[model samples]
Target: MQKAVGIIAEYNPFHKGHEYQIQQAKEQTGANIAIILMSGDFVQRGTPAIFAKHQRTAMALLGGADIVFELPSFYACGSAEYFSSGAVSVFNALNSIDFLCFGSESGEIDTCRFLGKLLADEPKLYKEKLRSFLKQGLSFPAARKSALAEYLKEKDIPFSEDFLDTPNNILGIEYCKSLAAQNSSIAPVTIKRIGSSYHETSLSSEYPSASAIRRELIAAWNTQKFLSDTLKNAQPPAVKDYLCALLENETFLIEDDFSLLLKYELMKNTPESLCAFSDMSPDLARRIYHHLNTFETFTQFAEQLKTKELTYTRICRALLHVLLNIPSDLPAISPAYVRLLGFKKESSSFLRILQKNSDIPIITKAADYKKLLPKEVHSLFEKDLFASNLYETVKCNKKSTAFTNDLQKPPIIL
Candidate 1:
């Protein structure tokens, strides 16, 4: 059987544990090709990815993936459902991806499937139970577990472990649901994460978590040897260079951009407008408005106010929406074209697969996007353009790349 596995990842810094997951995916699925569909400039946690798409793609290819593709930014920054949905849809289009591999604390699929069915088919009663649990002061995860227990009490469904403790497993279930909902042919596989926890700050062995790895990198300027194997194993594209680029060029400065726009938006925001920002619960928005004057930096404001139920990531996402003018829900749209990041000669086969079936243009140049897209997409394209230029500035000493349309392609820097 010929099986090709697809992965959706954000290797903010590639690590060893990630390598173990890829190895397990291939071993379990008997897959030869590992296709990674990853976030671009930003990650799921609503921060700039430690590195840009081009660098990340290069690292993914080195790590083990046979091919790398960009997950659209809209889907990349949204909820788990949208993030997984957007990624799954792209894999679905490829036609060759037969398995979807992800990391989960619980390596069991049967329990995930059961929970998924309930979440989708039994929305109202389940939601109400969950809401009731939350009103009693349970955290979201705790409330969810309590609600699930109540829903499954009459039945014999076995929740193998403390489900609330497993973040990857929760997300893994989301992936299963996405695959099933889309009716995609991809089979789901979960590799149990090893070594450190997802959000752990301390490092022990070669396979340190991404959080630990990021901290190490941020503290020290060195990368080559200092990078943990867990991250180096994944081969996240030249991250040190990227971060330096961002710092030097002031890419982190949000003035005149989304963050500034958001500051203005928040001051003028009506309760009703705040309500439209999805995760901004009615109560939370009121708190934000009441507390906006209390903090200075966005991170400071978010960290001081949020509860465990509303994670720092979720709070940052909500803030991003206010700044970027992203609507609560995004409509599905074609990529306009498949833009190449970095690919080894081996990626030729992968490109062939996409080019053969891709619905829109497959572009290697940023300049070509204007001709292919409508004016509305310009704002979206401009962000990407800025991201690309900013990313390039990080990789090279001098600014050697064009911000707008340049037909000349960047050589695949291995």
Candidate 2:
């Protein structure tokens, strides 16, 4: 069996930095194949991906990933814990995956692993401290960080909360925790993120953040232009056209893209009914309902609803959940299938190995999904299908073209 390295990513635009990570993972693990578990049409920050999933998958294969699998919308649109666990579960189910490669600000795999164990175990002292912190009105992330820092201090353990503070590091920690919880054999490889913070909105010659690129691309589109020379130089050669088309055609989807539709959904349904969404608290639902008529866009509404307790992103995500009608009570189950988005031509043998050894079904064709998946699995899959359709509607509406339905989209083969 050949060693295979797995990467969990959004690839929101398949930038140069992502290509660098793929190359580094292959070299560091000495793996024969690189597998990417990517978010589908929707992404974790409560927004649609800049390019369609198929375009992103093609870019991944062109950038050297051997196989690309979809992280379904249910998990793709979730919080860090759920998103990481979902991707890790898919990797764990694969028979040949050996190492999980991820980027982190700390670039310390051992520290991530230790913290993962602590989180998975949740010692009594840690839990007590966590409750105490939450009672003080800190957000979940802040509360957890404080509790962990306090616990580490009392135990005289040498650790840094920097991992918890940085976005990629926090996700890396969740990946490790998921691995520990599942008692999986996959080893973790950490690559230190080079240049620019995750949220930095400025371009860097070496490695601009994804947020920065998206902002620049959108700005360029709004000005009826394409990427400038410097920005173009920073993109992978393969995705340049995709990026250009997305911007030129105005197909880019942001959290604010669904503003009108979300407002309609909120106005049409009772505030109490929205409590069935995962992120919507009763108070939060009422707040959104109260401001539904005042704000013209989801961004405006989210900002109006924001406070020290509610971050803008959190409010956006919650509104998305409500708009999509995500069940307040999603069943707790590992992802039930692997949906291939694309793959390199040379990776045929690896697919065979997965088909033979994977516990979950590998779905390559959308039409076959219904026949092959069980009732519960099919139900879960419907959410992803609905999300894709909604995303297509947004794209077509933007371009004023006929719908390019995803049901007819065959997996892209490079």
Please list the C-alpha lDDT of all candidates, in the order they appear.
Answer: 0.66, 0.84
State, as a TM-score between 0 and 1, how close model 2 is to the true structure.
0.96
Q: Which of the numbered candidates is closest to the native, going by highest TM-score?
A: 2
Which is the leading candidate under lDDT? Answer: 2
Q: For model 1, what is the error of residue 229's alpha carbon versus the real structure, in angstroms, after optimal superposition?
A: 10
Report the number of clashing residue pairs per model. 8, 0
> Which ten residues in a row are the worst by lDDT in model 1?
250-259
Cα-based TM-score, every candidate: 0.80, 0.96
Residue ranges of candidate 1 with Cα displaced over 4 Å: 123-128, 134-140, 221-272, 276-278, 331-338, 360-363, 373-414
- Kindly report the root-mean-square deviation of model 2 from the true structure over all alpha carbons: 1.5
Clashing pairs in 2: none
